[model samples]
Target: MNLILKLIAGIVAGILVGLYVPLTGVELLYTVKEIIGQLLTFTIPLIILFFIASGIAGLPKGSNHLLGKTVGFAYGSTIIAGTLAFMLVSAIIPLFDGGLTFNAEVATPLSNLINLKIPPLMDVMTALASAFIFGIGISQLQLETLKKVSDQGRDIIDALLAKVIIPALPFYIAGVFAEMTVAGTVFETLQTFGVVLVAALVMHWLWLSVLYISTGVLLKRNPIELIKNMLPAYFTALGTMSSAATIPISLRASKANDVQEDVANFSVPLCATIHLSGSTITIVTCAMAVMFLSPSMDVPSLVDMLPFIMMLGVVMIAAPGAPGGAVMSALGLLTSMLGFNDSAVALMIALYLAQDSFGTACNVTGDGVIALWVDRFSKKAGS
Candidate 1:
C-alpha cells in the first residue's frame, strides 16, 4: 500500500463521509481532526528547533560560510516562485470573478474526550531563535555531544512522524475535509479559488523548470534527465504534502544525480526549512483570492507586496517543512499586516490545504536543483 495512495484514499473517504455520511451524533470523528491538527502544531516547533539546529550544526566549520551563498540562492528562487504565482493568479482570477461568497456555517466546538496538557512552545520566534542559537553555537564549537543530542531530538520527531502522525494522516485529512463539508466552506472555497489552484500548479512546474533548467545547463547534465530521475521525490512530496517528510526521497534523488553526500545532507534539510518556492506560490495566490472574494479588501499592488513578499521570503526560512506550514507562516502577516478577517484567514487555510501537495512537490523537487548548484560550487572551490 503506497502511503500517497492511502492518503488519497483518506481524502476521498473523508469527502464522501462529510458529504454523504450523517454528521449527527458523530462527535468522535470531529475529535480526530482536532487531535491531528494539535499534533501538527506540536510537531512544528520541535522540528524547527531541532532540524534547523542540527542541520546547520552538522556542517564543518570552514564549510559554514557556504550557508550565506546557499541561503541567497534559495531565497532568490523562493521569491521568484512567489512572484510568478502572484502574477499568474492575479491575471487569471478576474475571469472567475462571479463573486462567490464563503457561507460558512456556525458550528459548535467539539469537547475534548480527555483533558491532557502539554506545555506549549507556541512562539515561533522562540523556535527560530533557538534554532539559530544552537545551530550557530554548535557549528562554532563543534560540540560532538550537542550534535548527538540534536540528532536525538530530530530522531524523536521522526518517531512521532512514523508512529503517530504519518499513520494518522489519512484520518486527519478526512476529518479536516469532513469538518469543512459540515461547515459548508470547502465547496465554496474551491469554487472561488479553483483558478488560483490551477495557476499555482502551473507556477510550481514553471519554477521547478527554471531551477532545474539552470542547474542542468550549469552542470551540463540534461535537464529533462534530471527531472525524470526526480519523479520519485516529486510524487512523494505530492502525496505527503510535506517537505520534511519527503527529505529522504529528495536526498536520494539528489544522490542519484551525483550530488555529494555532504552537500545532499546539509542542503536537503536546510532547504526543507528555507526552500519554500511552491508553498509561497500557493500562499500568495490564495491570500489574493481570499481578499478579492471578501469584497471589503482588495488585493495589494505588486509594489505594495514588495516589502511583504521580501518579509515572506525571510519568514518562510523559519516555516516548518510540514503540511500547511507556509500558510501558518503567512497567517500572522495576512491577519495583522493585510487586515484579513477570521473568515478570510479560514478561507486561506482551506485553500492552501487543498493545494498543499502540489506546492510541496514543487518544494522538494526544487531542493534537488539547489543541491546540484551547491555541489558544483563545492567542487569548483575544491579544485
Candidate 2:
C-alpha cells in the first residue's frame, strides 16, 4: 500500500511538473533539480559504505561455503545475463530501423584534466586491489557487538532511502525530464532512435524473463512459483529503480527461494551493492550503439576495451551507492577510456534514465535467481 502511494505520488508529481513547468517558465527549476541530483550523488556513497560494512559485519562466521556458493552464483549469473542481454539487444538493434544517428554534439568534455593514459590492465588491477582492501578491512572488523550496531545503522539508512530518498526520486526524475525537455534533449535524440530505445527495453524484459526461468530450472523450482515469489521485489525495484531500496523485498524473495537466513542476509546485501547486471548491460549496449551511430567517433575497439568494460561494470556496483554518482563514474570511464565527449554522456544519460526502471527490475530479479541457486547448492553440499 505504501509502495502504491509512492508510485502514484511520483507519477502525479511528474505529470504536474510536465504540465506546469512550461507555463511557469521556471528557469530555476532545472537548477534546483540538478542540486537535488547532486545531493543524491553525495548521499549514495555513504549509503553504500554503511550498508556494505554493516552487512559484512552481520554475516555469520561459519557460513563460508554458503557465502562462497552464493557469491559465485551471483557473479556468474550476472555475467551470463548481461552477455545474453547484450547479444539479444545487438541482434534486435538491426530490426529497429529507427534511423538513429549518433551526434558528437551531445558529448561532454572531461573537466580540466590532461588525459592520463592508464593501461587497461593496470586500471583493472587497481579496481580489484581496492575491492580486496575493502573486503579485508571489513573482514577484520568482525566484532559481534559492533556488527549489531552496524546492522542497526544500516536499517536506519535503509529507512531513509525508502521513506526519503525514494520519495524524492520522482521529483528528481521530473526535474531531469523537464530540463531535458526544455533543452530539447529528451525527444530530439529519442525521436530519431526511438526504435533503438524500444529495442533496448524489450531486450531488458526478455533477458529478465530468461534469468528467472533459468533460476527455476537450475534450482529445480517451479518457474511460476519463482516468479510469484519474486514479483513483489520486482515491482518494488521497478518503482524505486534502486536495488538498495528494494533490498528488504529481495531478502524476502531470497528466503522464499529457500536460501538460508544467514546466507541470504550476507549475499543479498552484497549483491545489491555490487551485482549491477542491468546497469552494466545498459551501459555496454548504449556505448555500442553510440559507437555504431557515430561513425567518425574514434571509439576504442571492443577487443581493446573489453577489459575496461568489465572493470567499469564492476566499479559501477559502487555507483548507485552514492546519490547521482553513477553519471560521474560513467563519465570518467567514457572520457578517459572511450574518448566520449559530454554530449555523448548526456545522451547516454537520457537513454539510460528513460529506461532505468526496466534495467533495475532485471538487476533485482537476477539477484533472486542467483540466491536460489546458491541455496540449492548449499543444501546439496551439506547432504
Candidate 3:
C-alpha cells in the first residue's frame, strides 16, 4: 500500500511539475534538472560497481554454472532483441515521409563504434579486486556474528534510497520536462516524427514480450501464467523506471513464477546490474533516428551501418554506470565510427528520455523471463 501511494504521488507530482515548468521558465527548470541529473550521474557508477562486484563476490563457489548461464542468456537475448528492434524501426520509420530529418546546426564528428576506447586496465583490475574483497569479507563473517549487523546495512541503504533519493526524482523529471517544454522544444523536437518514436517504443515492448514468450515455450511453461506471475514486478518497474531498484520485486516475481530459489537469488542481482534491453533499444532507435534526421551527412546505407549498430549494442551493455553513458557511448560510436554529427547525438538524447520508462519496463520483464528459462534448463540438466 505504501509503495502504491508513493508511486501515485510520484506520478502526480511529475505531471504537475511537467505542466508547470513552461509557466515558470526554462532557466529554473534547466538548473534544477541539471543538478539532479548530475547527482544521479554521480551515484549511478558507484552504485552499479558496488552492487555488481559485491553480488558476484558473494555468490557461493558452486553456483557459478547457474550464474554463468543466466548472464550468458541475458547478454545473448539482449543483443538479438536489440538487433530485431533496430530492423523493425528501420523498416517502419521510412513510411513517415521524409521521416525526422536533423537541423544542420548540430552536426559534428561521428566516432568509430567497433574500436571502443576500453576503460583503463586498472579499472577492470579494481572491479576484480573489489569482488574478491567483498566475497572474502562475507565468507569469513560467521552468520551468527553479523546477522543483525548485516540486516542493519541493508535497511539503511533501502531507507536512504527509497525515502530520500527516490522522492526527489519527480522534481528532477519535472525540471527536465519543463526545460524542454519552455524551449518550445517538445513539439518542434518531436514534430513529424512522433509516429516513428511511437513505432520504436511499441517495437521494443513487442520484442520484450516475444522474448518472454519464447522463453516460456522453450521451458514448457505457460506464457500467460508467466506474465501474470510477473505483474507486480512489471508494475514496479513501470513506476520506478530503474531496473536496479526493481531487483527485489523481480526476484519475488521469479519465485512466484516457479524459478528455483537459488537461481532467483543468484540471477536477479546480476540481471539488475547488466540486463539492459530497454536501454539498448532506446540507444539504437534514437541513434538511427538522429542519423536519418541529420541534413549534413550522406545517410549511410542500413547494410553499411549494421556493424556499427551491433557494436553500439555491446558498448551500451557496459554503459549503465556512466552519466549520459548510454547516449554518450552511442554518440561516440556514431561520430567516431560512422561519421555522424553532434546534432544527431543531442537529438538522440532528447528523444530517448521521452520513452525511457517504457524501455525500463521492457528490460525488467525480459530479466524475469530469462531467470525462469535458466532455472528450467538447470533443472533439466540435473535430472
- Clash count for each candidate, listed in order shown: 0, 16, 15
Best by lDDT: 1
User: Candidate 1's residue-wise lDDT over 1-383, tens digit each?
Assistant: 25546656765676677778755523466677666666655665676677668767875455554676568778888888777777776787777676565433325343546454444475555776788899889988878899999888977876676677756867766665566666766676556656666766777788888888888787799999999889999999877878988888998999999988988888887788788888888888777776666556767888877666776786675454446667766665675567775445545665677687888888889888888888888788882
Error of 2 at 341 (Å): 1.6
lDDT of 3 at 9: 51
CA lDDT, every prediction? 0.72, 0.60, 0.59
The order of the candidates by lDDT, greatest first, is 1, 2, 3
Tell me the RMSD of model 3 versus the true structure.
8.6
- Model 1 misplacement above 4 A: 1-24, 64-67, 99-119, 190-196, 212-274, 286-361, 364-383
TM-score of each: 0.70, 0.66, 0.64
Candidate 2: Cα lDDT at 34: 50
RMSD of each: 5.1, 7.2, 8.6
Candidate 2 structure quality by residue, lDDT tens digits, 72-158? 666666566556655665565556434666664522111222232323323423443544455446567655665566567657766
Tell me the lDDT of candidate 3.
Answer: 0.59
Kindly list the per-residue Cα lDDT of model 3 for residues 302-340, writing each as its tens digit.
Answer: 677667666554444434431233453354455556665
